[model samples]
Target: MHWVFLVLAGLAEVAFAFCLGKARLATGSESVGWYAAFAGCAALSFYLLNLSLAHIPLGTAYAVWTGIGAVGTAGLGVLAFGDPLTGPRLFFLATLIGSVLGLKAVSA
Candidate 1:
């Protein structure tokens, strides 16, 4: 329930980040749509995050939410936009994910 909302919020955060990148790279009318999508996703992400916060601790929820978004966005960038996934970058991303998992395990 709450976890689901948190996960969705994190996914929305990824959508927002992707839309932002697309908007920046787009031209003319395309940029407008991208910006609009970015705004919508950002709003949805925040709303869901707020909902989850009602149940989860602030620090734990926030860390996990951001962690999911960061990993998801980076993965998407690599697959969709040809962003580099160098060794060090992957290692650090894994570390972040581990930290997030650790936080979740320690939390109630």
Candidate 2:
């Protein structure tokens, strides 16, 4: 259950990063609804991650949250925004995802 929140927190952080770019593009000033939504999503992401830390160990959750957010965000960028997905980069990303899952499995 708590792990679910952790995953969600990571996803929200990804969404937050994505929205930040959109919000900036949309408003040009980073103000109003987009600003509020971006900040609010980021804040909520941290809060949820913190809550999960009570049961899940800070180090693991932090690593997982950061790792997943990074991977997820980059993947989205590659797929949606035509960012680079070079062989070495993809290899490294795959390694990261595998290691994160492996660690989680070992911990569990």
Candidate 3:
């Protein structure tokens, strides 16, 4: 259950990042909407994270959460915003994934 919360929080973090990116590309009311979405996601992410902290270690949870957010946001940027997906960036993301998994394994 805590793990589920953690994953959801991480996904929320990604959503917030996506919202921010969209907000940047928007204008007037559209940008305001995106910003509102960002705020909602951020609040949800933090609330879920706090809930997960009841069972998960702070360091592990934080790392995993940010890991998910970073990888997910970067992937979305590449797919939606024309961000470069270079070899080095891919390599690092893979490494970050491994580290996050490693933390989960050890913490569990």
Candidate 4:
């Protein structure tokens, strides 16, 4: 259950990053809407993180959260925002994922 919260929180973090990117590309009222979405996602992410902290170790939780955010956001950037996914970037991403999984495997 706590892990679910953590995963949701990480997804929310990705959502907020997406909102930020959209907000940058948007104009006028549209930008406002994106920013609002950013705020909502950010709040939800933090709230979920706090909830997950009740059960998960602080360091492990934080690393996983940021790992998910980084990986998800990078994927979104490549798919939606035309960011490049070069060999080095792919390699590093895989390493980050491995580290996140390693942390989870070692933790309770």
Query: What is the C-alpha lDDT profile of model 2 across 3-41, one tens digit per residue?
Result: 888998999899888877677567555556677788888
Q: Report clashes for each candidate as comma-separated counts.
A: 0, 0, 0, 0
Residue 34 error, candidate 4, Å: 0.2
* Predicted model with the maximum lDDT: 4
Which residues of candidate 4, in runs, are more than 4 Å off? none
- TM-score quality measure for candidate 3: 0.98
lDDT of each: 0.95, 0.86, 0.97, 0.98
Q: Per-residue CA lDDT of candidate 4, range 1-108, in tens?
A: 999999999999999999999999999999999999999999999999999999899999999999999999999999999999999999999999999999989988
lDDT value for candidate 1?
0.95
Model 1 lDDT-worst window of ten: 99-108
Candidate 3 clashes between residue pairs 3 or more apart in a chain or in different chains: none
How do the residues 1-108 of candidate 1 rate in per-residue lDDT, one tens digit apiece?
Answer: 888899999999999999998998999999999999999999999999999998899999999999999999999999979999899999999999999899878977
Model 1 spans with C-alpha error above 4 angstroms: none
Candidate 1: residue pairs that collide: none
Reference-based TM-score of each model: 0.96, 0.88, 0.98, 0.99
Which candidate comes out best when scored by TM-score?
Answer: 4
Q: What's the lDDT for candidate 3?
A: 0.97
Better of 1 and 2 by lDDT: 1
